[model samples]
Target: MYRVWNFVTNYSLLLICGALIALVWANIDAHSYHQVVEYPLAFNNWVGVDAGYWLKKYGADYGVTEVSTLKVLSFHYLVNDVLMAFFFAIAAKEVWEAVVLRDGALRGRKAATPLFATVGGMVGPISVYLGLAYFLGSETYDAVVRGWAIPTATDIAFSYLVGRLVFGAGHPAVRFLLLLAIADDAAGLIILAIFYPSGELAPEWLLLSVGAAVAIYVLFNRLPQRLDRGKQDRPNSTWVRKKLSFWPYLIAGALSWYGFQESGIHPALGLLPIVLTIPHADRSFGIFAEAEQHLTDLLNHIEHILKHPVEIVLFFFGLLNAGVEFSSIGSPTWLVLAGLLIGKPFGVLLFGWFAAHPMRLGLPQDMRTVDLFVVGCVSAIGFTVSLFIASVAFDSSTMLGDIPVQDAAKMGALFSFAAAILSVIAGKVTRVQKQNG
Candidate 1:
């Protein structure tokens, strides 16, 4: 049991394995698999009836009924945005938790400059959008700009896996990887909350949600210090202590789900709220006080339950949202995919490299700063988050050739994902960083 936990903690490959399995499942079954991840309304408010009426009107001349159109669009949005929130939260929680635990390793280092990498990450994707937007007319650009923040964000698992393969453990790249990734994520989330909220805002409801989060934070703050002492004081029964302590973070996460959904930001931001609820593992106990030991044990237990599902759900949701007619990849897709794959690294490397040098924020002694750009390139793997942005950015009513904005989103995500994978693998195979070094 300890060995299993140790492996999952050291690397999240197991989580990725689960994600691949789920993606395959979603593709095989399609519609039914899509439903389990579905969350149509923020407050469980209904949209199907009115949405059907409008979608039907839009597709009527083309013989596509509004009902079918609305069904597809709504399902796509819910799966990508609503479901992917949990994925983001779980990824965010793991990376953030690791950074918090690794003691002073990055407190003063230039490699610790997550903010600089974050800036480059943000600039890279939006730069892609701005460049693409030039080809688009004005009205189209405004809607898409909301989603510009999407392409910049990176999943911790994806970024870290690449880092491990590229940097090798002898390098201090691990610390830099955690800082920059978390900072980049935090920057993206902040932008999303501000720019990408639901067009419809219920201020009173959002306020209530904020109140709920503050209250949760306060309540947990009041929890017993060194939970081990509390455990030793009572509960002679280990089973009782084990069961209750194990799920604090998961329960906290679900509550955060409800809160963020109500709070106007996408509900996926709920992951951070849940992360806040997870107390730092009380590692101070060399004594291994049963209570602190249990808390440590509890994290080991809860991490699997909460974390594995995130990858599985996101990967499958991505496949559902991303599977485009490969037949369409010829002109537009190849161009778009090329930009994300090629252009992103160019911008990120150029920008991150320049930024690191002026500030003397050198790369890990073992890592060439050029590798930072590689991380940035991988960060461009924006499938889950980017698709969510597309849902909010494009209109189902808006036209793009034979497809709607939602369809364009699906295409873009698949292209970006494919590009990210190929480029990163290519970076590895060619020793791009090594050549640069």
Candidate 2:
């Protein structure tokens, strides 16, 4: 019973269940689903005006007047923009730890192999998407070109889950996939920040965001030292110090999020900059290395506290965004499917082979080319981040005629389940071949 409970509550299982429930609920009664998602959670109308007046005053400045109003917060906004900020923060921390920490995938000269594989993973999908778009002629090309990054994402939970099922626990291939996914996530964040802006650039807000991130870094590093210097012997001193240490980062993250939003960039991108600013522990200690004198590393602390919350956030994120009408599938659907299913594996294999040979990077000793190929297939499952990009790439208000395109993209994201099945089959085949040999 305990094992069953553990399995059910596991992060990947929870995400899958959430996505499944959303699909069933949406299909059973899409009207209610839409109504619930679109329902407004109104804030105080302090100025005592309708939504339109606020839109007219501040909306044009941001170029989102047609899409949003300040009068209320919809459930979609709550999940995607606000709640998902923490999700992105977690992702940012993982990326930072991997690249900057001593025990990370990029820590040593040979350890950097996965980084190159990540580049191939991203490049393969994007190149395939663009090539397909070009061959499909001008109209199809224009419609699908904006979503070139959609197939490049690897849903960490889903891909890891499938990889584990195929390769078993503690396999080197699984570790490779995890590192590749982390790199893919970093790339996805960069694409989101560069390609998806809400409106006209607000340079002033961008500057403020950068300044806020810098200040948070200074405070995160210095706060514990200042506290320890004064009161080491006090009762509950450790607890008090821990509690106080967290607030500056919390406040700073919120400030930076707002600044990014005001800057016309997606606020989730704000977490990336803030994450980079956090002090990393020495590489000698390990990935979750503690700070000197028992001071908590801010990045590790944030990840620990927010781990469960981020899982919950992912559930709500899937529930709010994963609902898709199957009947609405079209070109965008096929394009995304082709890019992820075909492009992802090809890129990973081609680039991975090159990196191992010409680049003189090392692959895990036990991992065969077949194992790498299976991992490549597993990496094709692009769900969460892909859906987020689809939402951003095809706005209904801006492209009323292209509403179907957005829905098709959603359908493609849902098709990642097929990729998971393929990975399992590939894994079984490899296992059989090994046994026969």
Candidate 3:
């Protein structure tokens, strides 16, 4: 319990603090807030939004006439695009370990039921978000259809926290919720890469990212292990670990990030390929496992080094991306809420039942079928990743009637905290038995 609270304080408490400050600041003085969020840190052709586009969109408001420049790297871009890559890399490491390692949570038949439920979790939100838009009218559907993936996100940290509160720390449902959230994150990454490209697609540039991963894995990682195969002391591997350290992978990660930026995929996912190339321990202890802190592998060491820096990045992430005004609460807000609150529970229950009974995949011991619905309720607290999806799904210029669709959608994401209350109520209504490990 102490470890769980420590993880939340280190990662999520700062983010919530930043978000609350932004909400207050945005409502009080929107103009000043916008000015700070868009403040340009640099103007160069190599990265960031095009300078011509920025000037054309905001110059009249800022009383500027400059248009012939390279690009504008705003404060928002620095946190969301460049720094957030480390956040996603951490997520990818967890997912990679879950899939690749023996005895991993996501491997073998033990994961089948939860994996099926994960699919339903995503499908339910898309159906509700799109189906409601269709009923609103063809024009409404056309405007909001792009954001179908927004509600599918499940913020792993917040959901896990809420799950522990609702079901005791020893309950199997908590582990189920973790598995579903991790799989949902994996699916969300694929959705972003395929559907919401940052710019025009260029296939040739991806070769650079792939080449960097392959080169580093073969030259530094694979060669060192191969050279020390029969040697008990393993001097070559020791020298690489001691003398060179993480420099090789860091250099390769930079090249991969540039490749993703030029290739039009979101640069925040650029570190994923490099994450796979890092050396890891042979076994797994699950995410947020207290036992994990003692591991001496390079991957875990890198994750430990990043813990504080990523917390700071998440703070700026909330400050920049969560500044929607109260007036922005409109149809899209309700639509997103409905998708999360209404669709997710039913979707999880129905599919989870099918897998447990018909498909012969069983639930964890002492976990009743009703617990699936409560798990869904906890999973619907999609604060962090849902807010991120809303940002990339619709540009600020997009309008649905008189509302800014991006801001409205963001308000919906922010409101997802209500699901935490809903989850507690559901647990009480369902008469969940607490089990302390």
Candidate 4:
């Protein structure tokens, strides 16, 4: 009963927030939504406190006098390409802590978390998206490269927040859930790197980016084991320790971003070097190996400082930019809405449990099936990455002859947001009922 209340409180708020955003966007047109009524429509009001300013600024900054077509495209590219790289870097840091830095919760979930997460992650979106694609003779939208981003992402902040509430202190499986989310994040990054917008860029630049990436990877794999500076356990040379500061990585990452940008790749793949270069050497980590062990706290420290900001930005970016005015909201497009929020939870729940069943992998020891349902709800919160993927998949260029793909991405994200809300409500209500019972 207590568990139910916990889930409801944690899961329900996100849904409510999403609903408010969607309602405001779907119902109101762009400029009208920006206009603050009763404020007497002052110039400051028009040009301040909202996307209205930037939307106009981008129009001028990009040299597009008209806000009709190219302005939105410029805004879309700026937000998705530039702002999102920071978001992705933060995600990569989480992954770094999980897979390489050895975060504790991640350690606990190590056994089957990655596998189930990978599978559950794959099935839900493909099923929902492809099913729709088959139906309309074409699920033709723009920013098609963006589609891959949705399925691969898991909102770790929201998930972990729910996890703490649901699992309290004892359940080791929370860690596993954390790891699974990490894995989901990695998959999303791969999908973005491979599938996001690319065009005919100078092959030489593309090759340079690829080469740099490979070189960085090589250095990462070998460098970790060899660093012997301060007091790292395995052993390493003293000199390598000094070099681990942030610059070389910044340089490599910056260069890589340039190459990728020139090469026609999404350009954000440049964030990888920063991840590769985090100093893994821990003289203080030896305490964990002894009778009284504790690497977890230290891992948490590194993860928090390096990783948390990115997720925060990702969420903030979505709220600020991805939101649509829901003034005209209603049917016809509800299937896409249903597919994202509704079908997503259903398909993932079915498949996730199915993956668990044969192995008799009951819910995470302390978790109820309903808790799993809530997890499914959280999975449906695809905001940050979904917006990114939508932008990528439906290239800003792939306009439907006249309908701009950027607007289509904005619309798709709106639907995805709604879908997340519905799924959250389902979970929240069920949880609340169980709590009351």
Candidate 5:
């Protein structure tokens, strides 16, 4: 419980604070809030939103009549597209370790049930969100259909925190929830990369990203170990670690980021390739485990160094992305909320039961079948990633009647906090027995 709370305070509290501040500011003075958010930090053709798009969207507010010689690097773009890459890089690191490490949580038979449940968690939300939109009419459905992935997100930090509260620290469901959340994040990244493009696709430019990954891995990682083979001192690997450190990877990541931006992929995912190339310990201590801080592997070292910066990035991300006005709450908002609150529990429960029963996979000892629903309820707190997906899923210019689709969708993401309270109630209604460690 202490560890869970500690993790939340370390990573999520500032995000929540920024979100709350944005909500209040947006409601009170929307124009000013938006002005600050869209304020141009730089004007360069190499980065940020295109000049024509910026002019068309916001030039009137800024009183700019002509296209600038350079593009606009708004404060919003700096935070969401560039700086937030660090946050997602950290996420990718955890996912990479979970899948690649020998003792990874996502490995082997133990993960089967949770993985199945994760699929359901995603499918259920997409079905509910899109299905309900279809009923709302063609205009509404077309406006919000792209945001189907929003409710599939499960914020790992908040979910872990709530899981501890609902089922206690010792319950197997807590661990199961963590696994599901991690898997969901992994899937979300893939969905974002595939389904959501930051711009027009250019497959050739992805070569730069792939090339960077391969080059860095071979030159810095593989070469060092190969040279150190059969040597007790491991001189080459040690020299690379002591002297070069993470600089090479940073350079490679920057190149990859540029590649992604140019390739019309979200730049926030740029660091993902670099994460895989970094050398890591063979074993694992799990996400947010205290023991992980002691690991000297470059991967862990990078994550440790990134911790503070990523927190700040997340704070800014929340501040910039979560400033939807109260009036923005409409059908999309309800659809997002319904997908999360209703779809998640049933999806996890039904699929989890199937896996544990007919599929012949079994739950962890002492973890009841009903606990899967509780885990789903806990996983439905899709505050952070949900907000992110919503931001990318729709443009601010998009409207369904009077309501801005992006803002309405974001409102739904913000409202997902309600899942926390609902989870507690579900635990009680289902007669959950808390198992304190």
Candidate 6:
């Protein structure tokens, strides 16, 4: 009973619940859902705070002669654009840590297979998506060509959860899947930063963002050295140094986030540069060995503090983004479904096989080919990041318009639930195989 209670209260379960609530609310009373999401919260409008009044006042600032209002972001925008930035920041930190930290997943030759598999996973789904779209004729091809990156994402939490259920605790394949997912996340962040933008590129702002990241890196590296040089042998010196060190990173992160926003790139990428800039200890001791060292590392501290907050962010993220109007589902939805369901596993397996043979790097001793295949199936659960890309891919008013394309993308993202079922069945088969062996 206690275990069941713990499981239900887990972050994965919370995310699932949030998504389910959004789905039910949107389907049952879409008008109410829309109204709630669209409800205006005025910021710097200089008006009576009414949506209409704020719009007119906002428009005047831009020298528009027309009686148009400024673009006021809805509650949904606040959650996705604002809150999700922190989520991405933490995610970036995790990916950076995995690569640079001692005993990290990406540290040695052992990681080669999974790294290759990650690339394969990404390339495979996108190839399938584009091929399917092209074969569907011009209209479908044109509509979904930009959405190739959507199904390439792997929801770390959902995949991890399904992995635990299927493979039980402490499976090598599960760990491998996690490493692949982290790499996939890094790739996804790059794709979002490079591919999705709201307006013309502002290179100056991008420079500022990079500059801020460099500044943070410099400060992080130099501060401890300077402090040690002073050599104050006080009992609380460690605590003081740790506390003081965090402010620079906070300021730097804020600056970069604002810069990315101004630079017409997704602000979530702001953290990626900063994350890479943070120094990590040699992973000689192993991946989990840095627990003690994390106390002094600002990047690790920031990630730890964000662990709980990210859950809240994910909930609101789902509430805002997962409200798919199922009735509006169409052909584009199949593109997403096929890309994730079929393309994901095929790509993973194809790449894994190549890595094992021609590449001369074999799979982990404890893991079988079937285990890798099941991991690929688990990777098919492309939830959070996939939905985010879907939103970005279909957001253009000039090219693809919004509602229909966005809705179809959402339907495909929501269909990741099917992957959960596949994980369970595959997990059972693997468990039985393990017992028989």
Best by lDDT: 5
Give Cα-based local distance difference scores for all models: 0.53, 0.73, 0.90, 0.49, 0.92, 0.72
Q: Compare the candidates by TM-score and give the number of the best one.
A: 5
Q: To one decimal, what is the Cα RMSD in angstroms of model 6 from the true structure?
A: 4.9
Clashing pairs for predicted structure model 5, backbone only: none
Selected candidate, larger lDDT, 1 vs 5: 5
Which 10 successive residues of model 1 have the least lDDT summed?
284-293
lDDT of 3 by residue, 127-160 (tens): 8999999999998899889999998999899899
Query: lDDT by residue for model 6 over 1-437, one digit each (tens)?
Result: 23323433544566667788989999999877866765555443322123454345443443334433434555765677667888887677767767777677777898899998898888888988888889988987887787889989998876866766677546678678878888899899889988887556887888888899888776665555566675776324355446665676677777887787678787656666776666454542322233433554555666667767878877877787788888767767788888888888878888988998887899877788777778888999998899889887875232333447777777898897799888778667766243211
lDDT of each residue in 66-111, candidate 2, tens digit only: 5343444556777787778988887787777778766676567655
RMSD of each: 6.9, 5.5, 1.1, 8.6, 0.9, 4.9
- lDDT score of residue 326 within candidate 3: 95
What residue pairs are clashing in model 2?
102-283
| TM-score, candidate number 3 | 0.98
Which regions of candidate 4 deviate over 4 angstroms?
1-79, 101-110, 139-152, 162-176, 201-207, 210-244, 281-316, 323-336, 360-363, 368-371, 396-437
Distance from true location, Cα of 325 in model 6, Å: 1.1
State TM-scores per candidate.
Answer: 0.70, 0.83, 0.98, 0.64, 0.99, 0.85
lDDT of 5 by residue, 352-388 (tens): 9999999989999999999999899999999999999
lDDT of 4 by residue, 157-253 (tens): 5555554444443454445455556677778788877766455556587666556656654564346554533565643422333444344555566
Reference-based TM-score, model 6: 0.85
Off by over 4 Å in 5: 68-70
Off by over 4 Å in 2: 1-10, 43-71, 223-240, 278-296, 397-403, 429-437
Give the clashing pairs for model 1: 55-66, 56-66, 85-268, 228-291, 228-292
The lDDT, on a scale of 0 to 1, for candidate 6 is: 0.72
lDDT per residue for candidate 1 within 1-437, as digits (tens), equals 24323433433444344345545665576445544434233222332213554344434433444242323334545555456766666555544544554432223465335556666666666677667765666655654444455466555545554555555433455446656666766666676777776535554555544554566555543334334355665433244336556444456556666556555666657566556545555332211123323544444355556555665565456445554333333333333444456556666676667666886666656566666656666665655455556556555456545545455554665556564466557567647533211
